[model samples]
Target: MTNINNIQSISQILDSQSTKKSKSSGPAQGFESLLNSVLEKTQESEQGIQATELGEIPAMDFDIQTVSSIVTDKTDKLLTSLESYAYKLDDGNITLKEIEPMLEELNADAASLLEETLSLGEDDQSLIDIARSTAVTAKTEYLKFQRGDYL
Candidate 1:
């Protein structure tokens, strides 16, 4: 009876020790290997992005510069149109009726430019606002001339 009891106790101890070893062996190494693989893949993705993104970065900047150039051209056109409109209004030889159509076209062009400027990013918004205000001022001055109360 004493021998049988000792054998059962030894069997239980061995069973518990085997379970602990299995727990430390199977899932723990698997999880560590998975983590290492994920880290390796992430590093590979970062390296690939670094290789491919340099050209893309410059092209994006070029597009922004192109838009800025167009905005500058429109700004020049708007200022010139306003100047000509005011000049014709102040001239004594030219009749107001003849120049009115030209002023209207200039106003339309300015409005179109304003719409284009508004499409730009926050970096360009201040310029867009100024252009809009300038257009309004031109329109107001033209109306003032039409009323014979030019100031």
Candidate 2:
């Protein structure tokens, strides 16, 4: 009872034809192409990240007050080390076991202070000299203690 001219054919109904041409810049059409594109983009992003990470760091400038504070801190550490030794020595019953560590600490602190103060202005010459002398004194005291002089 159907009219033949109005009836659609099975082949026409299942046709896969495109009305327009695909652009070259359109999404990749195959699995291999898609995977390759993803890999290329990832490599590009990674290169950008690497360039940023490997960039040179800028130099820092320390002002006079900052430098002075650093030097003063080192000097304070040296003085504290010397004071600890003095207190232990004044304790009147100090043993070699106690003095050994204190002497080493005083020696280290004095050496560091001397090194730091060496770069200061001529106004700090006295401080530099004091640091040097303290270092020497600490070394000598340590040597004497090691030789059983205080035993």
Candidate 3:
């Protein structure tokens, strides 16, 4: 499954188990436990592939280069979209229809990147904030355009 699906599954499980959200460490511990389970499942699936003569394909694991690529690619695209939006605003010749699609794309990409970046072992709060804030700004602008505020 994709990283987005994996994150959604983890989020759902964490939500269901968060009866006491004030416990602070509960969520962190739960996340670690859930991640461990996923890794174990991946290992089991890999073993099955080996039994079938696939030569034990490597299982998925968090890789910094992979995460960095995802973050950089997504954020760069979002930045491009933002620049386009600014130009459109300045020209006063662009329509909501023209920019909505790009903003929506940025929103989707940023969300996925944020989730994957968070899965990294080292907590990079600045990257996390950038992803989150950019996504939020994109959504806000999209909604504003939809509401005719940008017309």
Return the TM-score for candidate 1, rounded to 2 decimals: 0.49
True-structure RMSD, every candidate: 11.3, 15.4, 25.8
Q: Alpha carbon lDDT of residue 40, candidate 3?
A: 77
lDDT of 3 at 85: 74
Model 2 regions more than 4 Å off: 1-67
| Tens-place lDDT digits, model 1, residues 41-145 | 768777774434323554343544666577777777878888887788789888877887886777677777776776778887777777777777767766676
Residue 25 lDDT in model 3?
Answer: 74
* Clashing residue pair totals per candidate (backbone < 3 A): 0, 0, 0
Tens digits of lDDT, candidate 3, 1-151 = 6999999999998987775564567668798889998787778877663334424578899755667567767777887888777787777667667767776776676667667667655566677677778777877777776678865
Q: Which stretches of candidate 1 lie over 4 Å from their true place?
A: 1-65, 145-151
TM-score of 3: 0.48
Superposed Cα RMSD, model 3: 25.8
